[model samples]
Target: MTIIKFLTLTLGATAFLSAQSSPIRSCGKPLHPKTIVQNDAPSGTVSKENKIQVALLLDTSNSMDGLIDQAKSRLWNIVNTLTTLKYNGKAPQVEIALYEYGNDGLQDENFIRQVTPLTQDLDLVSEKLFALKTNGGSEYCGAVIRDASMNLNWDGNEKSMKLIYIAGNEPFDQGRINYKETISKAKSKNIYTNTIFCGDRSEGIQSFWQSGATIGDGKYFNIDSDKKVIYIETPYDVKISEYNSKLNDTYVYYGSRGSEYKNKQMVQDKNAEVQSASSSVERTVAKSRKNAYKNDHWDLVDRAEKDADFISKVKESELPADLKGKSKEEIKKAVAEKSAQRGQIQKEIEVLSKKRQGYIDTEMKKRGNPEADDLGKAIENSVLELAKKKGYSI
Candidate 1:
């Protein structure tokens, strides 16, 4: 099939004037500034444990509503995929950062905004993602790619799998920054820049989306952004959901925003459920893996697990109402009980999740298992392929 690459260059006279002005409408909260830390460790040594760092740069243009919906639905599934990976017989720490570009609601010159920095707090990531809104704006592929590469904290471990996935329908070479140069810089930092074009394969190739991936030594994929994500129902889903509810009851909140963070966890649960039962199940499965789902910032059980002196050092006022009046010894015992209960509940969910996966796999084979051409599948395929090349195993 013949491909047509359209490069439209229309420089509005207002571009320069509006560059210094605020956005006409609010995009979200102010972007937090982060210092860029480069990984300088030698490639042959293991100074620190391996980690998986992924940055998602999405286009929130007026016509990309379907793409956003697919991302929301597939997030938990993506998380589940990561949980299955192991490096040197141990699960690596997973951090995800989010960025939204090609939206006029943003005040930046490139119309790009960082939704969240690379973080282990999955709930915060979910919260920021759901808050994104689309607006008609110029898509600057090169500029956003450059920002994500230079801003977020990327580890320098040679064995670490660091990736940047940028999805959009615009020409890959647009904007003031050249994609080739930006992507080359990313490669020097051991970051692969994957490109997902929300259109036909030929069109994506012609538009230079494929080139973006090639330049950064990463994968290029084309997806039908308008396609609806379908989920297969399994009999094990209901039981898993019940166990997930019991698991939620095992968390002990602490800190100033302890109650608020706990509420956010439930809110993210509802958000996942809103996507589909399959998504909710995927999230519960992710939560069951202690290696992937961690809430040390707010949950006393997780905090104590990481820091032995946390209980003794924590002020009583920071504890939840139920534990505020209790002595440190009593608090420690309570946290221990909750941790033990959480561990057992997690095991039950993990077993059920395995059965659930088996059922889904069998059903898929019966139906010929057509490939899903969406945001999640694109990332999953590329991640596994690149991760294996980095000497990691799934």
Candidate 2:
């Protein structure tokens, strides 16, 4: 399985202008600005650092609202499951890329929209998931997979698990690109491609969904797209939610989008809650995971702590109001204080989350629903199995 890596680059004005002036092409056609960005990786060799990169290509065509809903509601559960994985006693970083295909709302030239490049920023992933709207359109599984595999900076490390899970209800063979070639390209790069058909198993198998998985050495699953997910609430839910709120207060916002990012954090918090209390709890659990709750891009505390010279690089005007006018030493002290507070909250959430998960597991077993084959479970099971084969453990 090939894991998706999100590369954030600070290119020179010349390169930036060139990329802006020329249109990005996918399958020899001009890609929509919102669809894909070409050559986004920083100039250098691709890193072989161990991590799990999974690209989720979903069909957002009409009558697939249930599929989208399942994704939105179960994302945190997937994160929580991934967090438990360890390789050589060290936790591997997880990055996810999102693609939405087969939506009438999108352009025909690129019916597929790269909702996000491979990214470790889970909040950004959540925001993108929430923004998806379903509409009738053509579903091109092969084209999207080829685009992602060709365009994204996938690490070439055989030790890393790189995977593409394309979920749709349409025939596997569609559009201009050939499914066989796409799977072959993925295999050539050591990327595993999985197929998830949101319909009957036999129908999916007959439609080439199972064959797609077989070609790429990945799993095939057919799920009832409209199945309602039931979550068993635990006694730790309230405390966990409270700690999540406290966790938010500890963030020290900075940079131009500081306030906006902070607000987005809260918005996602509410979005999780709206899905279900259990979903919110799972999200907080994800936040507590090691290497999961990163916000160095917009948070002054994280930036200052991660980069010793972060304060020196930023202009005075760019600093948050509270951080402004303070000496470097004073600013460092403030950030340290908030960091300590955040760490404490995260520790508490971690402890409570473990208990919550245990309770849910016990309840599920008792209810005889231990074998629920929902979207999250299917993805988690496949990822864990593949990770284990690649020397990872839970």
Candidate 3:
């Protein structure tokens, strides 16, 4: 893409990103900010790189109609907002999945519906969300927790963090499965959950839902309004592969500190203050694909790869922050170089990762997860294997 185009997209995407900004630190401060109490990355405070898995658990109860209506209207805003993180990636790579409940919890058989599996494809999530019609019963937070932990593909890479978000109007308590077991399983595996309360807590179901969140080692927030619920967030690990080229400066700062945020407590909130930001979504016109949301990243993959040179240029430029009327040639050179290097690193990582995955695929064919195909158990061992390889203390 041309320089003019890139700048335009970055400017457009920032408004949306402000809402999902991590609460871990105020989007305040220079790249290196002073904290209330400096918690260093040493002592296993954070991970050098970030890998994230985000799941959305929805409430399909009869009363959630208006909430769902607003969801369709504003879903794209969230995606546009997240595009701001593209600076670090061959493209800003964020993978999100969705789940909805309330389809007959009163019956003894099925209560959960897997609208879309965990995916990088955002359109699948959007389609399912739009298709969602409220006509189910017995919304139970515990079921969603258990089902995701047991069935969803939760990536437990040592360099990454796995997050599950459960949103509903009903309390999570009262389910057939052991509620404590559901929460305990998630906590033990480092898969955190965030609960968005949809009903009136004062009416008394609040305590039950809160307790469920406590056991799951997750945070629960009450959403009284549409805007508040749609943007729910928690501190999540973002991979080196997702930052956009336009964000070269921001990427360099955060990439350096990624190791620190790795193990630290990542926090998220429904509302956040926006900081200086930009994303390329506005530059190029999104194509006329049937499932446009999922295809959002299609052409962008090339754009991300082109940034490999840019990544390296930025690393070397050591561009002094105070550009007092610098020449255009100098800035363009730095930008091009940084973009190329970022794309190159992403390419190399992809090669190594694919080679490694090929080895695992072969092994899995022979061993079948080193445990039963059980989701929770499979995730547990996956974490062990990844941590062992990464030289991290689990």
Question: Tens digit of lDDT per residue, candidate 1, span 219-288?
Answer: 8989888888768799999998888788889898887888988998999999989988888888888777
Give the least accurate 10-residue stretch of model 3, judged by summed lDDT: 1-10
Prediction 3 global C-alpha lDDT? 0.40
Question: What are the lDDT scores of the predictions, listed in order?
Answer: 0.74, 0.70, 0.40
Best by lDDT: 1
lDDT of 3 at 340: 64
Ranking by lDDT: 1, 2, 3
Pairs with steric clashes in candidate 1 = 39-156
- Candidate 3 stretches greater than 4 Å from native: 1-50, 80-92, 105-108, 203-205, 225-394
TM-score against native, each model: 0.87, 0.86, 0.47
- By TM-score, the better pick of 1 and 2 is 1
Separate clash counts for every candidate: 1, 8, 57
Relative to the true structure, candidate 2 has a C-alpha RMSD (angstroms) of 8.8
